[model samples]
Target: MPKTTETTLEINLSALTHNYSYLKSKLESNTNFLAVVKAFAYGSDSVAVAKHLEALGVDYFAVAYTSEGFVLREAGIKTPILVLHPQPTNFKTLIDHCLEPSIYSFKVLDEFISTASHCKQQDYPIHLKFNTGLNRLGFRASDCNNIVEKLKATAAVKAKSIFSHLAASEDLNEKEFTLHQISTFRAVAKNLESLIGYKPWLHMCNTSGVIHYPEAHFDMVRCGIGLYGFGNSANEDQNLNPVASLKSVISQIHKIKPNETVGYNRAFMAEGHQKTATIPIGHADGISRQYGNKQGFVFIKGLKAPIIGNVCMDMIMVDVTNIECSEGDEVIIFDGIHKASTLAESANTISYEILTAISQRVKRKFLK
Candidate 1:
């Protein structure tokens, strides 16, 4: 990869391939792999990532919304796409696109069945989302009989998979709660299978569960962050690589004398002579106001330059006083080596927020 001359998000397909293989290695030979490519593939180019993963033989793809799946379909993604959350309004559009929906509630399930029936569809695949412990969008484990009853009354929909989300599969401290969730999911799958008279794909593990709990991998595992990097633990993180790196170039350099203030609100007043670099990325570009006033740093010429003052909407001033860098020099916002997790930590957040928060306007460059 060449040095970035402007604000760019580099998506490394090779890194994605490696991450995918690493995650797949933890699963059984017959287990399915569902790649979660929502939120613009965690703010990298979704089409590019999905196309590459499709070539790598991912069993399925999961997106948060129907529109995301539509985008994938537009990109010619042929593998099955599971829309994790589908609104009643998009049920028609979802059916038109042949995207499967996760039937979480009786309302959503009923609406989808009606939509599918009205569309004259038969046995349209839909995943059953059970609320084991996430307490988010899912049907209760006790709702198994209701789901069975609903399925029996309709040929418009079919339960292709039964799944749930692990609230804290990455946190070992929540092992007991996680275990309970797993058991509940298992019981639901068993009861549902008995009632439905057939087996649907059973999955509960997310990225962290793939790393921490292989026994819960079940029939399929949905991996999101781990596929992009950061394994939710220091030990596991060492094994995966981040697929995206946000880079920019210094737009200008400023030489400030003692007592000179910089940026909005005079938030940073130089105590001594300082040199600052204004990079073309800020709150609007996903650098966020939270990472201002020396709370964050970017790597320039392989040296750390702390952000000096308030983060502007379109730019930020970093104290590059000691660095021997010039205008157009490459600036590393966060890369595999620097790690978005570290920058996110400095901002009192996590890797997911920073990674997915990246602005879509940033020009994407891919490393094949």
Candidate 2:
């Protein structure tokens, strides 16, 4: 791999496969696995990730929007693709590409039914999302009867699966709440099954849910961040290999005397003499302004270099006074050593946000 001056997100396909295998080991032999490749596979190259997972025999792939699934389909992905949030306007495109939709509400169900009928589609597979506790998206428990009635009323669509989201699966303190959610989902699934005369695959476990609530694995499991090498907790994260490494070169170095300021808005003033290095990536590349003002740090020659000032659109300045580094030397923003979770914590966010926020402008290199 040739080195480049610009920032690059290096994706290790081998680590991705390792993560998948490790997560699969947590499930029963018969249980199915659904890989969430939404948000460009959490901002690491969706098609590449999806293709690799597909090759590894992922039972299903899910994306946040219809267009995301369409992109996968266009790339010759034959595995089943689920559109987690489907819009009424894209129903035609969804069917045209053989993509499934998660019908979470009455409006979505009604709209999809109408669209499927217009397209003359028979037994179109669609998943029903229930609001067990998250209360974000999903039909209420009361909506079960209505959902069953709607499905019985038309053969245009079929219930491919029934699922829900666990709001706090990772928090051990929220174990009771997670259990309640699992119980609620179970009851909802039973009700829908009795009404429909059959059970579609029932699933409600994300990565954290899979690790903490193995009993709630249901008929299928959805693994998102876990596949990207994070387990949501330190103990669990230890077993997974981080797949992406954000790397760049120190473009320039500056020596500032005492009382001199650095970066825009004078965000950092040298307490004494200081050495700083400017890297080629900044807010535009998804290193948010929230990471500035010394809130975040990067690794240079295996030493810490705290961010010194406001993150600019195309660059950032870091105090490298202690680190013995030079221009063109490698800088590690977040990798195995400098975990994305650590950076996210400093930025008052989560690893998911940090990973997905990495802009498309940053080139992605896949390592097989």
User: What is the per-residue lDDT of model 1 for residues 1-368, given as tens digits with 9 covering 90 to 100?
Assistant: 56688899998999999999999989999999999999999989889999999999999999999999999998899999999988999988898889999999999988999899999989899999999888888998788888899999989888899999999988999999999999998998999999999999999999999888889998999999999988988888899999999999999999999999999999999999999999999998899999999899999989999998999999999999899999999999999899999999998999999999899889999997
Per-model TM-score, in order, reads 0.98, 0.98
Residues 191-303 of candidate 2: C-alpha lDDT, one tens digit per residue = 89999998799999999988888999988999999999999999999999999999999999999999999999998999999999999999999999999998998999889
**Full-model lDDT for every candidate:** 0.92, 0.94
On a 0 to 1 TM-score scale, where does candidate 2 land against the true structure?
A: 0.98
Q: Give each model's clash number.
A: 0, 0
Model 2, residue 38: displacement in angstroms?
0.4
Q: Per the 3 Å backbone cut-off, how many clashing residue pairs does candidate 2 have? A: 0
